[model samples]
Target: MRCLLPLLLLLVAASVAKAADFAARFDDLVRTATPRQLYALLYDLPKGGDLHNHAGGSDRPEWMFEILTDPARNGGDAFYTRARFGPETEPAARYRLIRRRTYEQLAPAARAGYVPLADLSPAERIAWANAFRLDAPGEGRDEFFNVIWPRRGDLSQNLDARLELLVVNLQAFAAEGLAYLETQFGLDGLVTPDGRALTPAEAAPLIERRLAQPDVVATGVVVRFQDTVIRFRPDAEARLSEIYAFVAAHRDRWVGINMAGIESDPRGRPLRFLSTLRRLRAQHPTLSLSFHAGEMDGADSHVRDTLLLGASRLGHAVNLIKDPDTLLLLQQQQRVLVEINLISNRLLGYVPDLTQHPFPEYLRTGVPVCLNTDDRGMWDSNLTDEYFTAVTTYRLSWPEVVQLGRNSLARAFVQPEVKAKLLAAYETRIAAFEQKYGAGSPTISDALGKVEKVKPVTYGYAKRTWGLEFR
Candidate 1:
């Protein structure tokens, strides 16, 4: 026993030394590497999944424009962006991308005011596209919550467009080494390019077929849907019941339901649907719930109430840091995972300074957390950027990075058998990654190729702040 104890202590000491050495090496790289070099390393890192994604918000403005302007693609449908000139309208007013079908249906005078995106001059197109993103300094909550969606109108409801965007996202995420994606997609309200509504029954087979395509299959990313309902709508309860029922029936493709939209709106209070959820649970209890809570800056018990609503995960629990008791509960219980979207939070004006964010605190306090791209396309960023932000901003240890990756899949709403397989695969992939890059590895550029070549998308934040010189 004495000899065994001594040997065990020696092995433990060696393991600790190895971990410390890796951390030191990683820290050195972070500190000394240029922006491009750091980006290469992160681009090559294996991210487990993105947990808080909004499907409608996951398309780049340019990509959307490509779809909208192509007559062959969008069933000959066209789109127009409202132009602003005089003092009467807001600058954001110039940014709305309206469907031509809807626009032409408007009064002739109203229709005359907008211009086809295709006919716009090159500079005009660029300016209109920029309006879809929060690239400008003054753009924030109002622009995102109010201006953007109203402009998108029925564009997101286009079934063919959404399916195509799904493939795009899967390919991009796969290139970045993300293996799973649980994004919010409503099952209803799908429309054809010509404006005919598609029943959920008709839409299901089409979506499944697209998902089974060769390119999507090649991405090797497991995709699951969450039936998302806006919480603040007057018919929220009815919508929640309908979506919950839909998810319950389509458990094979959909894993759960996510409640989102403006949290500060009184109509969307967490408790508003508690009884409805409880009633639904009585019938369809297995559906997972990962809700958007703690998003507001106001001091309130939304997080606690959301827990009472039975959320397995909390999306953007930014304000949880403000509620000491709820924070303590999260730390002590560790029952819920916090989906941290560092870039989205910053872009949305929730956390202006990344340093002041409570992500590291959540890690230290034993609350499970994972880095995610809440709306990567909208932010003009990706999974790599999220990891880069976390590492550079928080100085995360290698183990912390691995743990965050593990936590993402571990807390995912996938089936138990699939979860086990995902965890095992993650372990194997992480082991291989560490073996390649852990310590005494080649410089990032040598190890992972040039950053500009590796990263598929260039962030607007980078372009605005540092320019495109690095890329």
Candidate 2:
């Protein structure tokens, strides 16, 4: 037994040494690789899952434009945008970019201000595209929370458009090497082109049929959903109960419940839902909870309070560092995971200077953390951009990068068998990636040549932030 103990210790030490060596090599590559090469490598790197994604917010503007403008895909629905607001325009509608049913109800002057989405001039097209994202210099949380979602307007109510967007995301994520997605998707409030509302039961089958299509299956990405409720609504508790039941009933695809809203809203305080959550928990089978907590300008107990509401994961726990007790608890327990959205936080003004983000602190101190694209479409970014930001900003080592991917899958609210398969697949991919990029392999220039062939897709954020443009 004594001899075996020494051998085991020696084996562990060798494993640590090997990991450290790979990390050193990865650091060297990061230091030497140009912006473009680094981006390509990150883009090609295997990712585990996106746990904090929003279905509507994650749709790329260009993708949405293509789908919306196509009558065949959009169910013959015509959308109009307020290209130029008039004095008669309601204050709320002044900046709204698109409307469907409401366009006909507007006053003549207001109606005149709107032009069919397909009829927009060249400059209007650029403006419309820019309006969907936080691309301007001074745009922040108010512009995002207030204007961005409203701009979608009635387009968001279209069931076909939403389903098409999901397929687009699946293809995009697959291209970038993502293995799993747990998007926060809602089936409520959907309508046909003529504005006939559909029940959840009716909307769900359409989603199922679309997902079962050969194109969706070809992506090979495991997809699950969490139905979200705006936390600040007056009937949020009732809504939470309803969503809880809905998720339980639809456990085949929907696995969790999430509470999302602007964190600053006092009515959405985390503790307010504790009683309702406890009551619901007693009735329903265990459903995963991931609440948006600590995503505030000022720090408080929201992160801790959210844990009390039975959340196993916290979304945008940006201000979690402020609560010492909670931080310590997380570090020790290592039970809950924090979904970190770097670009989202920076663009939304939560962390204007990302160097000050608490993500590294959480990661280094033993709290489970994973990088995610919270609203990648609005940020005009992708999962690779998040990893690029983390690596360059934090100088993460190779082992750290691998750990992040492992953490994401480990913490995902997925079936046990699915999780095991994903983890195994991730390990295999990581091993192959390491072999491809390891020492004594192709020269960096050769790597760059191969990466250029891949023709990775980039957007405004990539070009603006890192001066990288792969088109």
Candidate 3:
């Protein structure tokens, strides 16, 4: 008993010392100055490869909205529908979903004629701008996208319009600090406002002919044209064949294919989609699938369903947390990258708020998770804002931010050599900045004091699978 007393004392001392170190590290982080120093640490960070992005206008809202309305594209249909919650939750008198001019819909909902898309009251042209008028609004996912539908009528079947919008946004993205984007743009079966069915094959030609101009492919900016599938389409098999063929024929231009909107999609479509996908793979062999699997609100059944479908990459497979087995699959395979969209979940009422978002938990355990803006313009968010939220809300430090960016780069869809090329350049710059500034600043500041020098950590973080630790 006497001997054990000393041993226990030793153990307690060690625990307390470790706790002190942890507290110190965090306290220093809170005092960080200039979001840019955090940016310098995280800026140009290898975002383990972006896996969550919409096809058109994934850039900025202003970039998306104004470009679409460009006289060159089309002087088109654009309106705003204020989104809202229930009567019990919202004390604003009534719930609504109104169709008003996008410009007029600008005022805050607290003002008159403001319907939160819950229950809307239409406003006239001048009043529309008075109510809600802005070419580029906040970056919430729903707000960004809700505007799209009202304007869809004015932008359909015009391939150049889509490309121009994307191109314009890409430039905006670069200006805003993003290095790359992996989007599933241009849908085939997706209905236009007038209800026209547009396919990848049709949209591909327009983009392809444009890329034929040389500057498109030479930009080194990666653009992945993801051929899409509607979950449980009655004609799933036939459409699957068409996409497989499209990808095969345009392998040079196309990166892969993905299944979209499969979560609540009816038709027992998941099983059928997987069965057809497996058959398609056997036939074509290289038709890669980045399926939107297990975005389940409350179940793990879809995780297994996605694996059965032979998905190489998993988009929004957020619900994988519900099952331990799927967690192992993600760790072992390390191939399926999840597209994390914190802002989207909040606006869409997926998890109530961003804190419940799964990325930090996914990362702590070593899963291949990447940060993406999802649909920034629609959601009224940007990559920077998402990164900021993660660091503050999730209490992520510089190292973890580095880790997330590293994960994004690792899981990126870019080819091996190309990724290596970018990662090398990215790391070199980081190393120089760190060495020039310091190993790690207790806090980043704009005042330009404190950081004497900064040096980069050599090589990137090793890619590994971390099991679920949060649950």
Each model's lDDT: 0.82, 0.87, 0.55
lDDT of 1 by residue, 1-471 (tens): 987998989977875576666666667667777777777777777789789898878887887888778877665777787864557766555657677677778898776668887888889888877777777778888888887766676676677777777788898889888989999988667767577888877888888988998999999998988989899999999999988888888888889899999899999999999999999999976789999999987679999999999998999999999999999999999999999999889988889888989899999899999999887777777787788788878888888988999999999898888888888888778665655666436665443443335554556765664353234
Error of 3 at 179 (Å): 2.6
Among these predicted structures, which one has the highest TM-score?
2
Candidate 1 versus the native: TM-score? 0.91
> In candidate 2, what are the lDDT values of residues 1-471, reduced to their tens digit?
987999989977875666676676677678988888888889989999999999999988789888988877777787787778658755446546454677877888768888888888889888778888899899888878887887778877888888889899999999999999999998768878887898888888888998999999999999999999999999999999888888999988998989998989999998999999999989988999999999998979899999999999999898889999999999999999999999999999899999999999999999999999999999999999999999999989898899999999999999989999999899888877765676434566555555566668888899999888996
- Which run of 10 residues does model 2 get worst, by summed lDDT? 90-99
User: How do all models score by TM-score?
Assistant: 0.91, 0.94, 0.68
- Among these predictions, the greatest lDDT belongs to 2
- For model 3, how does the per-residue alpha-carbon lDDT over 221-261 read when each residue is reduced to its tens digit? 56666766666657767877887788877776666777765
- Say what the RMSD of model 1 is: 3.7
Query: What's model 2's lDDT at 53?
Result: 99
Candidate 3, superposed: residue stretches over 4 Å from native? 1-30, 34-48, 57-61, 73-151, 187-205, 209-220, 436-471
lDDT of candidate model 1 versus the reference: 0.82
Rank order (by TM-score, best first)? 2, 1, 3
List candidate 1 stretches off by more than 4 Å.
1-21, 84-86, 90-93, 439-456, 465-471
For candidate 3, report its TM-score. Answer: 0.68
lDDT (Cα) of model 2: 0.87
